[model samples]
Target: MSDEPLSIDSTSNEYLINADELSTVQYINSTSQDKVLVDIGFYTATKKDLECLLNSEMFLNDSVMNAYIRILKAQPSINEREDGYAYLETTYNANMICGDTITSLRNKEEGNFRLYRTSTYLNNDMVFFPINIKDCHWYLVVINGRKGVVQVLDSKGTATRRPQLHQLVIH
Candidate 1:
């Protein structure tokens, strides 16, 4: 992608833009790789973050998935649900969980990643987890507490998300 400024389509009503957010969007498009582009509560996106968005071949990173999750949590449909929705970011340490023994990890001895805090997703009816496996693909795991359902949505359709599912079961 060229260093051309990112252009917003004025006709799209899907975005909820304010002066500050819009400025960040514009800056990310034109800024150098070293510059920080977006920083919104608990997540930061640098110019390097734009690679996933600009290049179709690149894997979507944690910043982008978390950013999208943040936006999803803000929507009316999500909030209007009877039990509400919560989201876990991409860096929730699914890789570590996939390893042989999570006994030590589950005891909270693992360094505190934000996902360790239950308050973020504990009380919600549905929790959305965006998990990136081996830096190759991302899958969205939706746990519907009210309905007693665990759904995994994967674009590739062949990823066996068994380890992540097993961890969630005991979590």
Candidate 2:
């Protein structure tokens, strides 16, 4: 958590050597917190690098969030799925169907679970489309169109490698 800022030598400055009439300020920090190292540099950043930075937790601050909201408002809506699925018109074709799982939540209400298996053709497309599954609600399947399989289970939950696709069948 040390905020010590390092200074760059004014004599060895590259921009000064080129006689560009520019002022450059540089800072360097070497520290580790929670097994994560934070290194930040200010300069000209490329679009791809900026995108990577946006996805990082460090960019979740108020200033970054406000900037992102402004940019999103200016951009067109990228969502193109008709069924309200995020990835309806992409190259991947996916379908959502009824599953064979019957599970009860902690509330003791019996509920039916539907499974939307990913097709080989749309495996890569899944990256762009994510299925939103709340605790108890209708699962929206996008990319293609059609339900796949079903699983039956008790209220108790189980964890799987891919929780979205696999239902932990509680006996």
For lDDT, the strongest prediction is 1
Full-model lDDT for every candidate? 0.65, 0.29
Clashing residue pairs in candidate 1 are none
Stretches of candidate 1 off by over 4 Å are 1-29, 82-90, 93-120, 158-161
Q: List the candidates' TM-scores in order.
A: 0.64, 0.20
> Residues 48-103, candidate 2, lDDT per residue (tens digit)?
22333323222323222234434443444533333333222111111122223222
Worst 10 residues of 2 by lDDT: 89-98
User: CA shift at 55, candidate 2, in angstroms?
Assistant: 11
Write model 1 residue lDDT over 63-143, tens digit each, in one string. Answer: 766666666666778655656555553454444554455666646665564355455556677766666665676677787
lDDT score for candidate 1 against the true structure: 0.65
